[model samples]
Target: MWGTSRWVRRMAQGLVLIASAGLAGAALAGPTLTIGAIVPQSWPSTAEGEELVLGMQLAIKTWPGQPAPTLVIKDSACDPRKAENAARELVAAKVDLVLGSWCAIGIAPRVVAEAGLPFVSANAERLPKAPDGVLQLGRIELYIVEKLAADLRAATGLRVGGRTSCWMNFEPVLREQYDAVLCPVLGFDKKRWEQAEATFTAAHRRPFTASVARGYAAMEAGLAQLRRIRGGKSASNDPIMTIFGPLPPTDVPAQADAMQLVLSPKLPKLSPRDQAAVTQLLQTKACTCLADNSCSKPGPWADQPFVVRGNVPKCPTLAAASPR
Candidate 1:
């Protein structure tokens, strides 16, 4: 949160488009379908966001036939104002559709609403209702919920650990939805993520008041309290994992840091189900959401599982994976 004047100026100026906004991948043969993607290219704190972009780039390269469509990678920098600017640029470029918004707060729909193009997300919280031509690859939050739910169902035949056994950072904007919708769906009765969303449509209110470190501290503290109250252990009693939304994918540093954070000394192995799903994706270079979308040939491997771990936040050009 800079200043009102700076924020207004940024809203108009757009992100620092340091990387050349070029067409990704080798020149393909077809009519060259064009899709715009806004990624968090410069941030250092968003991991889920980076992973998602990898999913999208993989889709465009391997799915849209051998000759992949031209993907214009723009740096939204995970900022709403920059996102708005990116949307305008995409519309101006006349892309067939917008791949999706980089950050959850960045409503890509609002940006390119007039463009008459589909706003699709390989990953994102499915808008309660699809906004006009918008389509999320999968219900974003559901990924975590589904992953945890399946595990829970196996552990306990019940829906949500038989009661409130967990807590999470709840987005204030989506508080009603969580209290009324998601938590109930997950079977969480009392314990839940205590974090709040970070924005406001009404303008008078601000989102969260702490920085990333502070927020994480708060989230961790609440989670510890919930775990203690719920009488849970790390592996056996506390078998359930927490659900955080996709980090800013467009941001490479964020993704890399996230990878280290989530996959290091603590828990790094994917379950058999997850391993299979990821392997299937890499083998076919295809997407679970659509047959038409796939990754580059001989794409990510079980061990490797990704490409371009930096600011780009994606599996790089097929060329990058296997330099031509």
Candidate 2:
């Protein structure tokens, strides 16, 4: 009896070791994930691009997971062909995810979508309807434009009244979206709008220009979504709905209609830690205001239909306004 009992125990131990080995093998064979980032590493938006990469790095470092992802950074040179080629290379690399700067390179979204990969643009000025598995991390300016027109009309009582104007010095993507979405919806002509460019080369603590803020916000929001998905807590395929849909608003109304009107909240409330950090960054390092220097200064629009801070128009006054 004693011999039989000893033999049974030995067999059980052998089975346990085999099962453990099988489990370990399965773990070793588990899939690994790679993230591809396409950005302009040189010229013009280079500073903003670098900030974007830093944000991505921060996200990866603070990821709430075991195995970290592999990030493959590709430079698109802010050129359409280069952006397309970068997308192709990422596809060839079999990257599972892609993050890109679509504002600088127009062809990025289309190429990424054609690859049928999950893509998120950290900044996009002219987005078409989101195809499945594609998302934009930054705020689309469509609503902002609409609001500006409405607020201006309400403040000035000036109707579109069959008037046409040219939009000058605007970014290509911004111009396109304005022509396509805002003009049609708001009943205005942006095809020939003329505006001055605002110069604040000596302005200090202006880290959060519209582009840089978008980059930082995109990284924070994207990383939060990724963490939720990685933890198997994501309930929806819509990235926006899954990550930010339920977040509460963290906006503070200012007496200046410009703050209330022009500065629409682009992001939902971030995690408590992120909220404090971002708030400080925007207030200190970044300019939460719009890029138009004249908007904040008293102008003809000030007496027409715009909010004024001191002598500066608070809300953006485009068409006759200047670009930052």
Candidate 3:
């Protein structure tokens, strides 16, 4: 009877030891990092926001790190109030880092910074000046507009009017008035962009946009910084400061057909000289300055412009009367 009791006790002790060992192994494995994302999931910028989230997810999946990070997404709905609330929620949840607040740049960055967290803005109309920890990944809207205007004027000698907002609603009308319309596109490696587009399309059954590319790049930049921090290679205490350094310019020769140009149906026939001028305008490179203020340099797709023509079904009534 005593032998039976001893055997049972030994079995219980062995089970406890096994469980303890399993827990110790888990402890050594460590928890995956949590990244907070605040993006619009409602009206206004819903499509762009969804693409941004998809891009971030793709970045996380493709990371070659030992333990991949996870995302905790909160919908900003493109509203300032909602974005502020979302920032608070992310802070409360103790996310290691924050990325986004696309349209709500006014409020979200401040809120996240106040909570002592790093904020990376993927898309903003203008760079936020007040927030100390904020880092912008995308180019400034006004700068792109100005660059396009200057390039067009220099190349075609045409007057260019700048519009900051309502691009989708007013583009058709604007295109009718203007000779050409230029927009900013994230400059990514051609092969890499193609691969990313394929992956995105395969998963979502639709094509991605500039917003998606921005989100992916922002996530990638953030992850790269995180890796540096983990490896004790980060130079600055602020991750934003460390990662905002100027990137080296690429030596890849510009491809002639790399520019995205769509000729407008309403466009009048151009002379050979005019056509050459337009081509020259399309090949002009734009400079993107780093957030660190270290350098102003063109990206890999510097010479490749993103030009879109007005998709108006019919030319304006006055267009017929006007001479080229």
Model 3 clash count equals: 0
Report how far off residue 189 is in candidate 1 (Å). 29
Tens-place lDDT per residue, model 2, 1-324, is 999999999999999999999889767544556888887777345765675565466456545554667788898866777888898999989887777763453667677778876677654233545555556643333234456555544433333111112111112122221211122111111221111001111223233233433333444455555655656765554434311122211121111221111212233344676455333323321233556432243333332222221112333222212222
Please give the distance, in angstroms, between residue 95's alpha carbon in candidate 1 and its true position after superposition: 1.0
Candidate 2 vs. true structure, TM-score: 0.50
Q: Would you estimate the TM-scores of all the predictions?
A: 0.34, 0.50, 0.57
lDDT for model 2, please.
Answer: 0.46
Model number with the top TM-score: 3
Clashing pairs in 3: none
RMSD of 1: 24.0
Against the unseen true structure, what C-alpha lDDT does each candidate score? 0.38, 0.46, 0.58
Candidate RMSDs in Å, in order, are 24.0, 15.5, 10.8
272: Cα error in model 3, Å = 20
Cα error, residue 193 of model 2, in Å, equals: 36
lDDT, model 1, position 158 = 28
Ranking by TM-score: 3, 2, 1
